[model samples]
Target: MANPYQPIEAQILKTIDETPTIRTFVLKPEQDVPFLAGQFVELTVPGHGEAPFTPSSSHFERETIEVTIMKVGRATTALFGLKAGDSVGIRGPYGQRYPLESFEGKDIYLVGGGVGLAPLRSLFLSLVHEIDKYRRVFLRYGARTPEEIVYKYLIPQWEKLKKVDIDLSVDVGDKSWVRKVGVVTCLMDDIPCDETSSIAVVCGPPVMMKFVTFKLVDAGFKPENIYLSMETNMSCGLGQCGHCRLGPYFTCKDGPVLTWEQIKDIPEPFV
Candidate 1:
């Protein structure tokens, strides 16, 4: 087994600005770091620190991985300043992956807001490879403003896929845009959420996630049937810290992706 505590070096191959405050770093690790979709890695900046981030790239492709980060604090600030060819340390593709098996024959609704789309993007990429295995895929993406939307470059391609319906909305639109204007939950009205055969995967800010959950429930999704990516202060990604604790579960060890029912008794994860 590899030393879970020691960080391995990974070189940044390229960086793409996803939004003004967000960037996606494409990395080439010295050795292959196998991981499943929805798992996260701890990345370290030599003199700065390490933080947990999910790989935005599909786990099926091991040659390289990407971490979509939003500049929010000191650690992320350092990450944002890094340029291509710079080195960073990484460890573990820790946490539970989305239950793809349970989703095999059900309709999948993917709801993401802002950078929360990172993990969902990874899952989407993995699922799309075997698109026919599922009944249908519906993506509803939201951003604070039109300028804040990430993955804008790929939506066109994703929309071209068969059996997939994709939509984008912003809390407020800009003069240059013409898409729907409203909170993400508003997108739910247009789709059918069959209680028996449809499941939803949601990720976003606390408020947004909370509202989306209520909307899904109102649309007939049972609590156990919905999955939420509740990434907290999962500092170690090794279950050694309590920062990411939710009641008795450690977000890093037991989850990152957990059914809504698993966390229903705890204080709201997003809160």
Candidate 2:
């Protein structure tokens, strides 16, 4: 068996600045790193260490992978210095993926905040790839301010697709912003799908997820039907590392994707 700890060399094909603190790197690995939506990868920044990140690109596209990262710590700061053509290491495509099969024939509601939108982009793209299988796709996203919104370039394109609807908001807005001004949860007030038959996927800051969960529950979304991307301190891509333990499960192994019902009883799950 191949050593799971070993990382394959990948070249940075390009980089796109999404915000002052966020950027997207397009990489071409020496070998294909196939992963389903919601799975994550450990990105190594040469001399610096590696950190876990979920790919922001569609899984259907095999030639290259895109990872959207926020420059918050040592590894990510080191990554910010590298440019196109620079080399990095990639390990994993780790953790459980979003269960796409279960979503078929049901309306899908995606709620994301700030860079949390990264992982959801992969899920959105996958759904769009086979648009006929699903009933409809509703995207509700919010950023702290207009400037911090990632994927600014693609949101319009996504909104134009048939069967997809998008609602955007910002905690604070400037003159150029014309969208709703409030938290992402505000967008949920006028949910266009049947709460009983739809699936809601959420990924964002812990605080945001916590409140969003409360709002969804209040809105009548079944706990099992609410999926969350809980990418906590996943130091290792394998289960042997105990850093990411949440009760009996390891985030890196059993999930980065877990249903709200599975974690609702865990004390401070959003924390």
Candidate 3:
């Protein structure tokens, strides 16, 4: 058994400036770290402190992992200062993962917004590993501004996969932007998949998830078939702390990824 509280040593391999506010850290862990798609790890910046982050890398690769970060507060700000060769503490590959088994014969719709794409990217990479097992894949991404988009470098590769279609949009346009412009729900407009044979995964801000959920439902997705990644309020990777409470559930242990049916009754602000 591994100690949940003790962090393993991980060295930063490189850092990518995904956007002005977001950065992706590639690390070489001291030991093999195996985690499924949609799960997250606790990253400790030495004396600065530790915080939770989803590995943006493919789960198929255990020796290396990628964690994308946004400079929001103290912990992240400290994380931003570190560069390649810097040492950081790491623990866990915690929480529930997406139900790939259930998605085997189903079409997949991945909707990501801003940094929320981090976990979705992990899931996407995992799915692509066994692409022939599933039917089709539709990836729709939305950002506040084209400048805020992450993973632009991987777009071409993801689009090249067989039976996969990728589209990008922004809520607002800039002089340099020429793609579709609107909310993420706007991408959900045409209702691409057969609701009964498809599953939808969404990750983003609370408001974005809410509206996206509504859109998915209106587009014929069953409440049980839509999954949401609520990687928020996670102060403790273990379930001991109640910091990530969402009504009666713990976002850290019980979720980080939950179906709409599981969270629909959790009251307001939780969609």
Q: In TM-score terms, which candidate is top?
A: 2
**Superior candidate under lDDT, 1 versus 2:** 2
Count of clashing residue pairs in every prediction:
0, 0, 0
C-alpha lDDT score of every prediction, in listed order: 0.88, 0.93, 0.88
TM-score of every prediction relative to native: 0.97, 0.98, 0.96
Candidate 2 structure quality by residue, lDDT tens digits, 104-153: 99999999999999999999999999999999999999999999999999
lDDT of model 2 at position 3: 90
> Can you write out model 1's per-residue Cα lDDT over 106-205, one digit (the tens) per residue?
8899999899998899999988988888988889999999889998898899999998889889998989878889989878786754665688999888
> Judged by lDDT against the true structure, how good is candidate 2?
0.93
Model 2 stretches astray by more than 4 angstroms? none
Q: Name the Cα RMSD for model 1.
A: 1.1
Pairs with backbone N, CA or C atoms under 3 Å apart (clashes), candidate 2: none
- lDDT tens readout by residue for model 3, 1-271: 8667899899999999999999999999999778899788999998888899989888998889999988998899999999999999998878898889999978999999999999889999999899988988899999999889999888988888898988899999999887889989888778677986689999888888999989888888988899998856787789888898887788789888989888888768453
* Model 1, residue 67: C-alpha shift (Å): 1.0
Better of 1 and 3 by TM-score: 1
